[model samples]
Each structure stands twice: as C-alpha cells, then as structure tokens.
Target: MQELAEVRLTAWVHGHVQGVGFRWWTRSRALELGLTGYAANKPDGRVEVVAQGPRAACEKLLELLQSGNTPGRVDNVVAEFSEPGDALSGFVER
Candidate 1:
C-alpha cells in the first residue's frame, strides 16, 4: 500500500478575514484536523497561512478556507506547495 505523504502548503486568503476571528477559527480547525501551521494577516491586506500535514488533511484545510464555519467573504485563494518546517507550534494570530 502507498503511504500518505505529508504536505506543506501556503495559502493566501484575500478578502475580509481580519477582525472577524478568522485566525482563531483557522487555528481551531487546523488543530482539529491534525495540521501544523500558522495564520496571520499580511501587510497587503491578505491572510497568509502555512499548513503542514497529510494530503487529505491539507485538502480539508483548503476546503475550510474556502468555506469558513460561520461565514466570510473570500475573494480568492492562492495556494502553493511548500517545504515542510516548524513554523508554528499552535495556531496563532500574526
């Protein structure tokens, strides 16, 4: 059987993500999904996130980013594969 490979992904969330408890919600969901990463607001008015975990888990994370638990406007999502690293121990607002 083929083993599931761990993947690191960088997601750029654009829209109204700040001041809406988006980081907290993202942290909670990432932790629940067994994903390790961090979410922060970029200087250019975008939410930047780096997540690392199993492929399936990462996919779920992307899905969550697209459709938040409550409701938020996400203009676009720019994601790319990244190299794994210890960026965050827990979800944090930055």
Candidate 2:
C-alpha cells in the first residue's frame, strides 16, 4: 500500500485582493480544509497564500482561491505546486 504525499500550494492572487477581506477569507477557507499556512498581502498589489497539507485539500483550496470569495475580485491566479515546508502550525492571515 502507498500513502498519499503532502503538498504545498503557493499562490499569488491578482486583482482587488487587498483591502477586500481576502486574507481573512483565505484563512477561513484554509482552516476549513484543514490546511496549515498563511495569507498575506504583497506590496505589488497581490495576495500571497501558502497552504500545506494533503494534496486534495490543497487543490480544493486553490480552486476556492481562484473562485474569488466574497469581497474579493480575483482577476488572475498565478499558482505553483511544491513540497511542503513542514513549518506551519495553523492557518493565519499576515
């Protein structure tokens, strides 16, 4: 038998993410999915989200992030998949 591997999803959400409650929404979704990581705003006018956990959960979160939660107008989602850093205790908004 084989076990599923952990994954990390790093995403940069563009368009109306800042000042629109994106970070808090991200933290809520991530926590619901049982992912551990953080969400923060970049000076470049994007929202950075890092989620580490089961691959399926991470993928689902990615989809939600791209779907533009309430109060956010997500125009584009630039995402990347990589190995988890294994350093997150819980989902947070930074």
Candidate 3:
C-alpha cells in the first residue's frame, strides 16, 4: 500500500484551557490517534498543540481539541495546516 502523506496541524485552543488539565487531555487524545506532537500552555491563557500525522488523524485531533475533555471550557480552536516537520517521535505534554 502506498504510504499516506504526513500533515501537520498547529492549533491554539482558547477558553479556560490553562488550568483544566487541557494539556494532559490533548496528549492522551493525540496518542490515541497515533499522532506525534506536543501540547503546552501559553502565557496568554491558551493551549497550543502541534500534531503531525496522517491528514485524517490530524483533522480528528483538531476536532478533539475543539471539544476538549478538560474541565475547562473550550471556547475556540484555531488551526493552521502546514507540511509536516517530521520532528516529533511521540506525543508529549510540553
């Protein structure tokens, strides 16, 4: 079978994402989707997630990020697509 082309999604999630275990939730979600990337908190009270994997998986991740499982409310998820960097090995919370 032909290998699927990799893609990247850089997402910024807003709304109570900083203190509601959003990072952990993101990491778990990404791992379950077989994605590689990092999730971290921004000083401006947002959660930043970078996911690299198949295009479909990355899109799924964006959906998950928008519907966050954390106790914090998910106000929005702004995602940008780009060529995969091929730099991540596994999902992690940064």
Candidate 4:
C-alpha cells in the first residue's frame, strides 16, 4: 500500500471564535480525523489551529474549520500549508 504524504496546516480562524469553545471543538474534529496538533486562542481574538497528518486528513480538518457548523461563527479562515515537523501525538486544545 502506498503511504499518503504528510503535511501541516496552520489555520487562523477569525470572528467570534475566542471564548466559544472553538479550540475544544477543533480538537475533537482533528482527533476524529486522526490528526495531531493543537488549537490555541490568540490574543487578537483569533483561534490558531495547527494540524499535521495525511494531506487528505489535514484538508478535511481545514474544511471542518470553515464549515460554519462549529462552536462559534467563523468569519474567515486563513490557512497556510507546509511540511510537517516534529512528532505530534494527540490533538490538543491550548
């Protein structure tokens, strides 16, 4: 079987995302997709989500982040793609 390429996705979620359990919701979605990373609250009222895993899984997570079905209203999502780094275990909410 051919292994899928791993990648990293850093998404900065904007709008009413800070105090609405967005990080926990993101962590749940990431874990369900078998991704590893963290969702942290930024001081600028944005939630930063970092997920690393298979390219497909990462994309799925990104989709979920902007699905408009999360804990809070996501006005916009700015995402960056890059190579995965370090060994990430479980998804986390920071």
lDDT of 2: 0.88
TM-score for each model: 0.85, 0.92, 0.90, 0.94
Residue 37 Cα positional deviation in candidate 3, in Å, after optimal superposition: 0.5
Residues 1-94, candidate 1, lDDT per residue (tens digit)?
Answer: 1126778878999988888888888888889989888898888878898888877788888988887452467888899876567655766667
* Best candidate according to lDDT: 4
Model 4 lDDT tens row, 43-63: 999999999999999998989
Residues 1-94, candidate 2, lDDT per residue (tens digit)? Answer: 1125788999998898899788998899899999999998999999999999988889999899876554669999999989888689999998
lDDT of 3 by residue, 1-94 (tens): 2236788999998898887778888898889999999998888998899999888888888877766566589898889989988689898887
Where model 1 places Cα greater than 4 Å from the true spot, the runs are 1-3, 68-71
Question: Backbone clashes in each candidate structure, one number apiece?
Answer: 0, 0, 0, 0
- Give the whole-model CA lDDT for all candidates, comma-separated: 0.80, 0.88, 0.85, 0.91
Off by over 4 Å in 4: 1-3
By summed lDDT, which 10 consecutive residues of candidate 4 come out lowest?
1-10
Candidate 3: 10-residue stretch with minimal lDDT: 1-10
Instruction: Rank candidates by TM-score, best first.
Output: 4, 2, 3, 1
How many clashing residue pairs are found in candidate 1? 0
lDDT-best of 2 and 4:
4
Q: What's the true lDDT of residue 15 in model 2?
A: 91
